[model samples]
Target chain A: MSHVSSSPKVRGGRKAAVGNVGRPPVAWALPGILFFALFAIVPLAIAVYLSFCHWDGLNSPTSAGTANWTRLFKDPEFRQAAWLSLLLTTISWVFQTPVALLLGVWAAGRQRSRAVLSAIFFVPLLLSTTAIAMLFHALLDPNFGVIKEIGPWFGIDPNIMGSSTGALLTVAFVGGWQFMPFHTLIYQGGTRQIPQVLYQAAEIDGAGMFRQFFHITLPQLRNTITTSSVLMIVGSLTYFDTVLIMTKGGPGTDTTILPYLMYRTGFQTYDLGYAAAIATALVVVATAISLILVRFSGFGNMRSTREGM
Target chain B: MSIDTRPVTRPARPLNRTRPAGAARRRRWGNPLAGLGSLVWLVLVIVPLYTLVSSSLMHQDEALNGDPLAFPTNPTLENYRTVLDSGFFTMLSNTAIVAVATTAIVLVLSIPVAYVAVRTRSRLSGLAFRTFLLGVAIPAQAVIVPLYLLISKMGLYDSLPAIILPTAAFAMPVAVLILSGTMRDVSEEMYEAMALDGASPLRMLWQLAIPMSKAGISTVAIYTALQAWNGFLFPLILTQSEENRVLTLGLFNFMSQFGVNIPAILAAIVLSVVPIFAVYLVARKALVNGLMGVGGK
Candidate 1:
């Protein structure tokens, strides 16, 4: 019943169908296979290879052995960027998850309010990251930005991005704001996959909303939570557009994260090898986290339903 | 919490029934906690946007001198005119071409792999599936260097093709994963019947898969379009000229160029957002459902 595949055993029938259909000569898949190989697989290999060499996008690459790799660990900027990214990931989980879940549950259950609230929330998600960045950037500016003025009214610094702590938190907050709707949708859709019977059963048992949420909703959303967590972490690890637009890893590198760091290094500094090394580290870290979650989290175990959609 | 006094009235039907009256009554009674939560959510999302839009319309002096939160008293389209007159249209066109081309290419390329992966079920198709799944984990930032180099080596450097080709490449992972998942939703018997009709895979793909997976296809198209439209790094690193700029890069350049012209910049940002927002409105459901496919499966 999972919307993903309907049944896992569909594969058995697929295999039988393949036998009768002659499996459409493998050549039929050439164009797609070639595209992936050249673009995805090959580029990954090239990145790995280039990570071990020094190149500046001009001359031939010279073998640098572990020079670039070693330098990444030694470089304080690299370390800071990596740390900030990790912090962003942590903040996303702490802030976005519960908030999105709350709004999502509320939206999913209600009728009239759901449409109104969803449209409001989903506006950010619809706007391009650049637009979101510009919107926040304008609002966060000290001189003319509106949020700065509001900050004084509320006794909080409107120019939060000016301070190191505020910059990091603000960046994380903006990132969360733009994406919370996305996570909210996942949760809303996930809430749908939860059968009404469960809530009805809880109601029949004289369970309160809190009790039902604790005993039913939380457990049922396990896979979804795992999936969004992985997404959030990986998203944080590789987040570039907002940071690039907002801070440019600025205010003394307070907001620098791995992807932006890699970008600045490669594009601005033309340290292709060093950037590739950072890129390799980012991919390794992201892939490792994702693999670990998938392995340990029972990520595919939401029974009788589709996964993400 | 106060106990509900309403009598519970379960539906005669078993599963998938609406909430009983008592439960609905309890929900309708409204939880203050939920109300507070909703109010907070609304403020968080709507306020910043209002600020952006309002400021975009304000005069520069007014924006700088007036209360930032106030709506524009002397609203003007001067900022928008400034933006449009400054080659914003060219950048927009470039962005449109990139987005459209990328989405078209991704759809053209992903459909076959999706069909093959689902119907062939061969080792190679499985490999194709795994390869695509692997690409999902490989962030574009990781391979961007090679992509840059490859695009340059192909003599596509500093051009729309440089951005378009790579954007399409990166989009394939999510696009393929989504399409294949939706394709798998096609019942085995459907494929069997197509095979019994002696349909070539291409015919089945064109006639059946495309029609049946229309929702998934639109989702892929929208996502790919979104990626291309919102693309920054590619356009930033690959294309360098004013003529080659897309909206994301264009907006960046426009902001810095008109630095401190907050209204003009905000107006430009608002203008840059209109097309994508329109697209999102049109395809909102597919976008949501498609995203769910990613998270759900």
Candidate 2:
């Protein structure tokens, strides 16, 4: 009020003194700054610091220096999990993204038709991951379950968890199934952004469904596709609970991805320091991936333009 | 970063128009195969969900001798009852408590933080936002040991607050990101208009900023609730007693103990899903309103 009422000189003096810093937006900023510092920043610092030590979960651990790091490079289990995470993420994203966009586009073509299909696809996503994992667990039981019930129809055995290859595929396939709805939802929104006139014009120009899809729909959905894929990749790379509930990383350590390995090391083996280091590495890797996705996906630019507006 | 080696970061090729839709359809139209192709995809998804739902209703005896996909000859709620009677109510209550607590904390904390992120748009707040994004990147497993240590050191282990605080912290980040995205959309002129009327910072927030940012706030609030409700790992590691068990942890226990009781586990699974189901069922309208609040980006 005083700033509003004060003379030009007084207001000018105040602005100059403040160096036009806008007073830190302290009213809205302070609480968040304080909360995140305690909750987010502090924990991160602890994780990073603990990464340098060799503390057993129960007691003090000597600083093992780079022994843990060196060991991580050579650990067959780590390599396997790393490969599995990368493979599943890349593969699932491969299968999930294009298919989801196609569905989203088809759905966007009509109203009621799309909503019902969208709801079905989104159902698995909305349900508990545990439920989905359990559902797959029962389905893959190989004894009395449906897969076993029809095991001989294709001369296939119901042995999803019986082998390393099978376990990885089961995890990947289920992950893809449960998560497709997210891509659909994102792609639906992106498809919605494309003007209907663009499609109609294409039709008038004798452009067929393939042409419209390739010429218009595909191009329009680029941002949405990228965002969904990035999310899928991140979720798969950190895959733990689903695998834990379904296979316990069993049939061997074949299924133990980086996250599962991290948990096993820290909690089961009681190597707190080693777990922290593994976690730190996971975090570093995840952060790099996240940066690439957010920066290159065209989202930052889109949002920045909106902000400027 | 492997991103340097990967071609994904490169520009995607422009869509190559090989075959136009009419010509493509004409090529396949007489075959009745395109319809069949889509049906196959739909069936693949539908079959599993159908099997799960139907199998849940089957009596134990029927499930064994009968076709797996058949509707149960005698549908029984006994499985549902057995799960209900087996202390699942407590798990639901505990999960509800944690989810509610976390959601409440996230709403209170994230609103202001997101608001500031929008207003300042400064390097510091930007850095702070990135720090929060650390939560998104760093899987909870990575920091679980230290987090457990931190909680226990504070003598907070196995407590609902132990679960609640970490979940909120983990979620606070994306909550802020989404909220800030929405908050930034609120025009600066609203603040200017309020300042002209001599509105205090607090009054402006209550009267203007919040009301304007409701959609984003709701998105964060609702998503935070979902995260808390479905959260598995934290509660799995933190809670010891049944009294402290969240539904996710409870579901795991129920599955292991009653692993063979298909109906009962199904009932438990059904019961476990009720809160979210109820929310989805009852709040469909609100969800649509909220869904429009955010996009994939």
Candidate 3:
């Protein structure tokens, strides 16, 4: 055995000169490709195909040929859902970015107390979204929740969830509360990666704290901002669980973003065809937005910030 | 230039006057405005968490009638008992199985793909990599209806495999990206060294690539596990039976089952978090890094 192994090892050593030594065959990628194709890619194609077919998910799907597509264009609920999804995406991006950026920068500091507080802040991220939604739902219960006692002091109505705007804002707020820490951690990582020399240079130039932040930190985090924003936008566009648990797209479909609308249309109303159309549209929009962001920010290029260094 | 001279002359009189040596060295003296902002956010984070815990410990009557933020006069595990009695364990086990199975599948499948992508210089490998890159933006929500159809057609509806298969599939993109990233870091010389031993590609992967990419592997495992554990839409739409229910759906059902029983609901929420919280406490750096990896870092 030893003699045979030695002979092959010698041959392998010689073969190394040919440059095909230990490279894996492309066949190694087959199982994964087939599995992803079967589940993800195939299902996506079926969704688009079913978008043009009429199926109540019962007997069989019959070709309806642009019927569902036309309905989707003119459906008032679909229009409203599309608009609300865009609005929520904007709200989430606007609300989450500044706070997460600031908190991330702060937590990136080396203070011991900041470390502890950062740990505390990370607690929400550990909880499942279901738990956070449930916790917030219970807290916002008008008759029996903390909101009742605190609303008067804050000059706010306790029945915030009962109104349309309040309900939508509440969804955005709850989602923000759960996700801000994740973005903050991203920003924190980005901040730590910044070299200390930049800060020293700004200090030598008599730049105030605000000026340094505006000029040095902000520009340096441009990639981080794009990354966090893309994530935030896509995340909020598909925001569903909170709507399901808290609002159920209620108070007159006010909070019915696209995902929730898809859920309602497909499962509840049994309009699976229309829901497929909506789902396809969502995929297109999400992919388009990400592609645009990646294109503009050159994030797809994966350029290193420390190029010269 | 004038402003620069003023700060140089009176450096000790401004924000740096009362700071520690470390702060002065880094020029990160506590900004009062930022400090104030952090305090405000601290309150925002703490208040609801305080309410969740405090209310869960109270009797339902106390929770309803008393201040929601007050300390429970007589804290008890009775609510936790209530959650335990209501089949929380079954759902917990189901979630655990889903998480484990999904992680296993994702790792077993994605590692090879990632390895081939990183090691092989071929157009097929490039196409495979781009396939996953595009897969990243295809939200699982978009494919749910067809998945439901496919699962039902395959006789998988209302089964754990129904959840495991799709969840694992969706987690592939990130897992592939992360694994390929780490695999790329395994140096050429290392492969050459292994090749000199007459090692097959499989042996090279096991001995060298896998060991070298342990960080990315662990990150992928954690990401898939969390994705499976917290998955809602798949469970909500695909599965119907209580026997097949996972934790998130279990929590969703608890709302209607324990209606107006706020303490019971809160207790269920807290119990659901306990396992992940324990993991977070012990493996915080790994967990945070894994989550950051989800954003394609």
Judged by DockQ, which candidate is best? 1
- Candidate 2 local lDDT, B255-290, one digit each (tens): 878868876776677778767877776665455335
Per-prediction TM-score to the true structure, in the order listed: 0.91, 0.86, 0.90
**Deviation in Å, model 1, residue B264 alpha carbon:** 0.5
As for DockQ, the candidate ahead, 1 or 3, is 1
Residue range A22-42, candidate 1, lDDT tens digits: 245667667877887787678
Off by over 4 Å in 1: A1-18, A297-309, B1-19, B22-31, B280-293
Q: Write one digit per residue (lDDT tens) for candidate 3, span B1-297.
A: 001111111113333345444345443634465567778888889999888888899998999999898899999889999999988999999999999999999999999999999888799989999888778789889999999999999999999999999999999987998788777666666677778788999998999899878878887998789889989999999999989999999999999999999999999998999998888877777777666554443
Alpha-carbon deviation at B171 in model 1, angstroms = 1.2
Off by over 4 Å in 3: A1-18, A204-207, B1-30, B196-199, B295-297
Error of 2 at B71 (Å): 2.0
Worst 10 residues of 2 chain B by lDDT: B1-10
Alpha-carbon error at A306 in model 2, in Å?
Answer: 9.6
lDDT per residue, candidate 1, B213-296, as tens digits? 886787688768877888888888888988898888988887789989999988988898888777666756556666555565
Q: Candidates' lDDT values, in order?
A: 0.78, 0.70, 0.84
